[model samples]
Target: MSERSFEGKAVLVTGGSRGIGAAVARRFGSLGAHVAVGYRSGRDAAEALCAEIGAAGGTAVAVAGDVAVPAQAQAMVGRAHDAFGRLDVLVNAAGVGPYLPLAEIDEAHCRAIFDTNVLGTIMLTQAAAPLLPSPGGRIVHFASRLAFNPLPTSSVYSASKAAVVTLVHGFARELGPRGITVNAVAPGVIETDMTADILRERGEQILAATPLRRIGQPDDVAGVVTFLASADAGWVTGRTIIADGGLN
Candidate 1:
C-alpha cells in the first residue's frame, strides 16, 4: 500500500498512552490519518506521544478518558470526531491484565476486566458507527492468544478477550450492510509493560511454546491492525487475525 493510503482519514485508538496502544496510534498517525490517542492515565506519556507525532508532522491529539465508563467511551469518540471532523476507524486497544486463578477471581477483578474489555468495546464501537463513512470504515478490537488457550492464572483476562472475539463477529454482521468492517488481533506474549512481570517470570516457557521462539511486540500486532484498517482489507470483516508468533 502507498504510504498515504490512510491520508485524509481519522483514526482513534483507546488506551493509546503506552505500549501496544501507543504503537497503534503512532502507526496510524504515520499513515497520514488524523489520529486520536485516548488514555485513562499516563498523561505525560500521552502528551509526549502526541508531541512526537506532531514533531513528525503527523496529526494527533491525546484525549483522556476511561473506557470502562459508557460516558467516557462516548467522549472518546466525540473527541476524535471533534478533532478531525469524522472517525474513519476505531481501534479498541485499552486493556488491563489480571492474572489470577479462576478460584481467586473476585467480583472486582471480573467487573473491571469485563467493563473495560467488553463493554468498553461495545460502547466505543456504537459511538463511532455513525461517524464511519459508508463503504469504507473499520473497527478493530484487541484479543489475546489466551482466548484460544488459557494459562493457569489468567482465566479472567482470557475470558474477557474471548468476549471481544465474540463481539467482533456480531458487530461485523450488524455493520456489514453499511460497509463497516469489524475484526480483531490476537497477540501472544508481547513485550509491553502490562506483561513485563509475566515476561520476567515465564519468558522462557512462552518462547519455548512459540514456534518462532520469540515474544511478540506491539508493532507485530500493529501491522496486522493497520492492514485490517486499510482498503486492502475491504473484503475482510468479522475475523480474528492472530499474531501470536505461532504460540498456539
Candidate 2:
C-alpha cells in the first residue's frame, strides 16, 4: 500500500442515495474504490445505486444511518470500516437546505438545518478521524456557495453551511499531524431532487447570475470531491473549494 492506488480504497458517502452525494459515491466506485452508500430513508435507491456500481465492475454497498445522531454517526463509520477492513475516505454529504425568511424561522427549522448540515458533519468527522489511515485519510464535507453569499431567504441554511467551513478550518489543523486532510466543497445551485423547486422558480435568475449560464450537475461537484480525497490533494486542507462555475 505504499503508493495507495485509488483502487481498493474504502469510501463512505453519507446521504449518498440521490443527488450530489450519489454522484460522489459513483465517482469513487468508478475509480475502483469500495463505496459505502450511506442513506437515511432512501434504502431502495441506495441499494439500486450499489447494484449499478457493481454492474459496472466496482464494489459498493448501501448502509443506512442518520448522520445527525451521534450514535448513528459513529455506527455508520464503524460499519464502513468493518465492511472494508480499512477506511480511507469519508465524505459527509448528508445535509438539508430549506430556505426560510428570518421571520419564519422556527426552532425546529433551525434545529433541522443545523443538526444535519453542521452537527452531522462534525459527528461524522469525529467518528472517522481515528479510523482513517494517517498518511492517506481524506474527509470532504458538503458546504454551499450560499455560506459566503447568502440569498434573501437563506439565513438559517446559509449559517449552517458556514459552520461547515469553520469546522474544516479547525479539523484540518487538529488532524494535520496525523496526515489526514479535511476539506469542503461549497457547490453552487446543483440540479438535484432537493433543488427542483428552486430550479423551477428561479431558473432564469440563477442562469443570468451564473457565469457558466447553466445550472451545475452532481458530477461537476463530484469531481472536486474526489480530487480532495485523492493523494494529489495531500497538501490541500482547511479550504473550501467553491464549485460554482465561478458563481462566487
Candidate 3:
C-alpha cells in the first residue's frame, strides 16, 4: 500500500495511549489518517503521541475519555468528528484483562472486564455509526487468542474476548446494510506492558508453543488492524483475524 493510502481518513482509537492501541494509532497516522488518540488515564502518553504524529506531518489529537462509560464514549466520538469533520474508522482497543481462575472470579471482576472489553466497544461503535460514511466506513476490534485457545487463570479475560468476537459478527450483519464493515484481530502473547508479567512468567513456554517460536508484538497486530481499516478490506466483515504467530 502507498504511505498515504489512508489520506483524508479520520480514525478514533480508544486506548491509543499505549500498547497495541498506540501502535495502531501511529500506523494510521503515518498512513495519512487524522487520528484521535483516546486515553482513559495516560494523558501524557496520548499527548506525546499526538505531538509526534503532528511533527511527522500527520494530523492527530489527544482525546481523554473512558470507553466503558456511555457519556464519555459519545463525547470522544463527537470530539473526533468535530475535529476532522467526519469519521471513517473506529478502533476499539480499550480493554482490561485480569487473569484469574474461574473459582476466583467475582462480580467486580466480571463487570470490569465485560464493561470495557464488550460494552465499551458497542457503545463507541454506536456513537460513531452516524458519523461513518456509508459504503466506506470501517470498525476494527481487538480480541485475544485466549478466547478460543483458553488457558488456566484467564477465564474472565477469555470470556470477554469471546464476547467481542460474537459482537463483531452481529454488528457486521447489522451494519452491512449501511456499507460498514466490522472485523476483529485476535492477538496472542503480545509484548506490551499489560502482558509484561505474563511474558516474564511464561516466555519460554509461549515461544515453544508458537510455530514461529516468537512472542507477538504490538506492531504485528497493528498491521492487521490497518488492513481491516483500509479500502482493500471493503468486502471483509465479521471476521476475527488472528495474529498469534501460530501459537493456537
Candidates in order, TM-scores: namely 0.98, 0.97, 0.98
Flag regions of model 2 displaced more than 4 Å.
1-5
> What are the per-residue Cα lDDT tens digits for candidate 2 across 52-80?
99999999989889988989999999999
Clashing pairs in 3: none
Per-residue error (Å), model 2, residue 101: 1.0
- 135-206: candidate 3 lDDT, tens digit per residue: 899999989989997889998899899999999999999999999999999998899998999989989998
lDDT, residue 16, model 2: 96
- Model 3 residue 98 lDDT score: 79
Q: Which pairs clash in model 2?
A: none
RMSD (Å) per prediction: 0.9, 2.0, 0.9
* Clash tally for model 1: 0
Candidate 1 C-alpha lDDT tens digits along 36-148: 99999888999899999989989999888999999999988999899999989999899998788767878999999999999998999999898899989899999998998
Per-residue lDDT for 41 in model 1?
Answer: 86
Full candidate order by TM-score, most accurate first: 3, 1, 2
- 1 or 2, which is superior by lDDT? 2
